[model samples]
Target: MVKSELEKLGLHFTNIDLGVIEIKETISKEQKQKLKSNLAVSGLELLDDHKSILVDKIKNVIIEMVHYSDELPKVNYSDYISEKLGYDYTYLSNLFSEVKGITIQHFIINHKIERAKELILYDELNLTEISYRLHYSSVAHLSNQFKKVTGQSPTFYKKIGKKRKSNLENL
Candidate 1:
């Protein structure tokens, strides 16, 4: 549906995954407004202003954990998410599931796996180092999750290699 809309607007998009869509050209504010209106007409929301604050809070915590923390604290993710977002865990969980169609745990895993990929690609650290950096229980656990999500072992994925890397937004 979104693809068809973009096509009708003469816009080219490279990827559409879950809640994200990637397009090459920068859209003007007027174009964005039109797109939003069109999406609303089709019963889809283009901008979720109401959820932005909560989303940002959730994303900030994840980013901080993934990028800044050397050791992840032993705390419940749901509790942490709820505390940070100032919402009940169940409510936040339900809202996230409704909007993303995937659990928060899955989303975190995907982000973590992507972070692991970046660490691997840099070649600055070994698997153990990467595991520690990403707060995986062990290298084996990290490898298992990576394989499960990507359908290839981390070593194999690195060997085949990415021609271009994904930015944070794209990831």
Candidate 2:
């Protein structure tokens, strides 16, 4: 979608990834506006500010790590984000909190909880396996966080999934 939008505006980008775009040349205000408007039509926004771009990069990294990666990294998340973004963890934490109104740890926990929900709904892994896959210390730890974020136990979520599935089949 983004590439097509860029092409529609005759813009040349050297690279495009999850949250990064490298244009071959500096775009004029008109082109930028057109690109922004075009992307907005597709439910995307152009991040022009440095802080917003950095925050978006942070989000993309976390999302990729949690939802897409085959396995969670075996290092501290702060250290991982710091090393990946080439900034101090404190600075990243402060910036993320200021911009997102949530700490980085909170963001990670929310995403982890979301991923846990997905695993539960899939019914492919037991809670223990899901805990290990998500790098929680134990099933209890995963369950606690899951309940904290989602207001329900993993078992409850799984049961709701089953009920929903049965309802859909009956319909």
Candidate 3:
């Protein structure tokens, strides 16, 4: 995995997840190039270069917003993404589709579903509460989307047990 490769290269990662990694110190250009080469072997690559930095920045913002926010906001995602990345939403969308092969909205929905699963597993709140917390229009809406993505109703997902839980990194 990329983490092991980075460790072998004498880089210590503070966090390692599916699409991102954070290290204690900044790596040099040469080191970064080498890291990119190594990561490419596993179908990963550096995302911070000039041509692709906007897409990377957008992805990072979405991850942070979904994983860290207690309540999802009602603000327009395109506006938020534009402000966060300092690029027009249209441009970001085009580049993201071209590079990642998925729309930004699809990515956000994936993260939201992942968050929903986590909240459901914790058993701290009912479906209605989780729906409100995550800004879904209604519990029915949430259930529909959840089933569409995961192929099971929230109740069924819970009753089936936690063995089917997905990795947070896979969101």
Candidate 4:
């Protein structure tokens, strides 16, 4: 639908991905205005500033790698992000920290914990498997971080998941 709208507006886009778009040609101010207005009507807002766009791209990359990818990278995440975005790791780190007020590493850890919770709830993988899947050094390490973030062990979280499912079934 979004691509269709861009096409209808006579914009030539080379690529479109989550939160990012590539236009084949420069768009006029009128075209941009029309595109923004059209997108707003559909509850989507175009990113107007460079910093906001970069921040969003950083977030998208992290989410994709940590939560959606089948395997974690062999390289460090900072190196991966820098290589992917073609920016210096230090600069990216500083910009992300300044704009989001949280270090990128912290954000990655939070996301990893969230993904761990999801895998635990799914009951498809055990703690050791989850540990390796998320690229944790060891099961003990995964547990420590899980406890630090959620104040609950993975075992307790799984029990909670079971109880929640049972409650839903009762309803």
Clashing pairs in 1: none
Ten contiguous residues minimizing lDDT sum, candidate 1: 160-169
* Residue 118 lDDT, candidate 3, scale 0-100: 87
Candidate 1 TM-score, true structure as reference: 0.60
lDDT of 2 by residue, 143-171 (tens): 99988888999999899989999999999
lDDT of 3 by residue, 1-82 (tens): 8877888778888898766688898888888888889888888777876657667778889988887988655687888888
- Tens digits of lDDT, candidate 4, 1-171: 679779989898888987778999988899999999999999998887898898888998999999999899999999999999999989999999999999999999999999999999999999999999999999999999999999999999999999999999999
lDDT of each: 0.79, 0.91, 0.84, 0.94
Question: What is the lDDT for 78 in model 1?
Answer: 83
Q: What tens digits encode model 1's per-residue C-alpha lDDT throughout 43-111?
A: 886754667546655667777776676666567678777777678988877777776788788888998
Candidate 1, which segments miss by more than 4 Å at Cα?
1-53, 67-71, 162-171
Return the lDDT, model 4, position 138: 100
**Candidate 2 ranges with C-alpha deviation above 4 Å:** 1-10
The residue pairs in collision within model 4 are: none
* Candidate 4: stretches off by over 4 Å: 7-17, 24-31
